[model samples]
Target: MRTAYRVETVRAAEAALMARLPDGALMQRAAAGLAGACATILGRVYGARVVVLAGSGDNGGDALYAGARLARRGAGVSAVLLGARAHEGGLAALTRAGGRVADDPFAVLARADLVLDGITGIGGRGGLRPDAVPVVRAARGSDAVVVAVDLPSGVAADTGAVDGEAVRADATVTFGAYKPGLLVDPAREYAGAVRLVDIGLGPHLPSVPELEALQHADVARLLPVPRVESDKYRRGVVGVVAGSARYPGAAVLAVAGALRGGAGAVRYVGPAGQAVLARYPETLVHAGPPGRAGRVQAWAIGPGLGDTPGVDEVLESDVPVLVDADGLRLLDPAAVRARTAPTLLTPHAGEAAALLGVARDDVEARRLDAVRELAARYGATVLLKGSTTLVADPRGDLPVRVNPTGTGWLATAGSGDVLSGLAGSLLAAGLAARDAASAAAYLHGLAARRAARGAPVAAHDVADALPGAWRDVIG
Candidate 1:
């Protein structure tokens, strides 16, 4: 699992570690790591021109000290100070090592081979300052490979929201642990690639993190493997209510996902029963309403269920229910909150925006905030699907699960339906709402990546690849 801490947590940990170490020891350690990373990026550092965007505080100090190391190694390093006062000690060290502060920031930036963005640290908020805007633009516009100090400037360290102009780095060298911003999107999109440098602050940090991404081993632990005594009934039956006459493929796709989601049997109830049976004859099909769909451990409702009456019946069931696609549209907040059973709502940006009564752009820009708000408003576990899928629980105590596995190929239609069915089946297999949602997303994204393999993949391919994805994780 890849865990990330909030800025406050990181600062507190840093302060505790710094108290035990000698004066300037921690900064030097950070600088050494930063310089090593810079050198690795610039293979031939002997005559490499490096520009450091130095700002106020420790971030600037790290950059300046790193520039000093580069200067000593025979690289021509220039510091473009963006604040009123640079790190005095660091500036002096850089000067002594033969690195000079450049008066013409743009001229040097335009000709630089690499740019170090220390313009803001994790604590800095609200984007780049006015004076630093042109320099950041020049660095980006140039051929320089930009690298951020901790995180890209102007991004919300905790929430991963970018409100204004921000530095877009080719790579980011983060210290100690990963910040929440570096894992989630908007800010993640700005940070091209990330490398972590250990500064020995692990012991000072807390056991629980602010956010977590489950890897293969973590998912393997969470996945339910059938026991010797397990039967079809004991393993769990997933009820899928999906597709209309207008779009029967949604039902087939959802069933495909549910079949491979570790559920023993899939009982599909909708208008598209004939279509589903055609593809999967083993599916127990019912042409009647979802109320008469018989026994099921959990119910997956709403992929292509266009204005259907079955949604209300499924929501009223005592079993766990997953709401997605058209079901998201017909959701009554009061009804959803009134339910005694667990409810999971999976919505893409547009669906999420409609649920919150906000613009789609607003939802995309602040995904963390949006997912949490949706979970609270709906009084259920909410899965906000996007480039970075997030699962947030209504209780708000647990850290939001950030899904790290995914490719652009997952944007295909019906991909979300597949996800909904898979997660619902997990719920049937007795995984908690948060665990089910997060695990399903991890597999779904991995399956998509495997199926696509640098080409476009249809939604069916992703669903078919789920079994392989599960095997890979467990093995």
Candidate 2:
């Protein structure tokens, strides 16, 4: 699983490593990796023009040391000093390697094949300093590939908040552990692709990780595996309270998703029986409220529920509830609060806004915060669906699950119903809210990726791909 930690956790990890080693050991390790990556990007070290945008802290020190390595290998290196005095040791190292400091601020950009943004790291707050902004802008305008030393300047390390201006990087080589900002949004938008440099801080980390992403393997392990003694009842029955005559396709999609969702049976409860029977004849369809639908191990609700009154019955059920689509729109937070069983809320940015009583743009801007806030407010586990799907639970530790497996094709219509069915089935089969949501997202994304395969795919095709995607994890 790909993981991320807060800035404070990073500093603590760095401190522990620094105490055990000789001075500057960690920074040297970081510089070596940074230099190697730069050499690869530039094709050759010799005669390559490299510009380092130097700042006040150790981040600049890392870039300077990397520049020194390149210069010693015959590259023409230049350090454009953004601070009055750069890291003393790093500046001296660069000069000793035959690197020159740019006498003119604008000259470095024109000749550079690559630019290193050492303007800020996790320690930095607010936006880029006025002096550094123009240089950052120039780097963006350049044809050269811009590589951020630790993180993109002006991006928040902890919250993924790009409150002010920031540098958009082609790549970021981060030291020790990943900052939470890289895994979340806004700041994530600036950071292109990320690579972690292991600086031996693994030993000093906490028992519960700060953030985590489920891979195919991890999701496979978390999924409920049927035993030799398992029966249909033991495997669990998923109750789907979805769709109306107005939008019968939702019920069909939900049942299609549940059939291959490892559930022994799918019990459909809604006004879309004809549609459900038409698409999936095996689904046991019932017409009326969720309470009247007989027994169920878990419940999936809200997709195509419309502005109807029956949804409240499903929301109030004792079974684990997976709320999505129209269910998200029609939810009564008070009823959700009074529910006895665990609830998982899956909402895209728009639905999330409605739940939080905020603007959709506001939810998207601070997705991490919005998800966490919703989980707390409703006392439920929230899966805020987006590029980086974030799962958080109220009354639990602060560890948030961020799904790394995502595709643009997931934006297609009726996609969420399939996800809800998958998650709800898992919950019925007995998994924690966090686990169910995370696993569902992982598999859902894998299915979408397989179905799309670089081309457009219909929602039904995505549902059809679930069995093969699940095999990727278990097999």
> Which candidate comes out best when scored by lDDT?
1
- Model 2 residue runs over 4 Å out of place are none
State in Å the error of residue 159, model 1.
1.2
lDDT by residue (222-253, candidate 2, tens digit) is 88889999998899999998888798888888
Candidate 2 overall lDDT versus native: 0.87
lDDT of 1 by residue, 73-104 (tens): 99999999998899998999999999999999
Which has the greatest TM-score? 1
User: For each predicted model, how many residue pairs clash, with residues at least 3 apart or on different chains?
Assistant: 1, 1
Model-by-model lDDT, in order? 0.93, 0.87
Quote the lDDT for 14 in model 1.
94
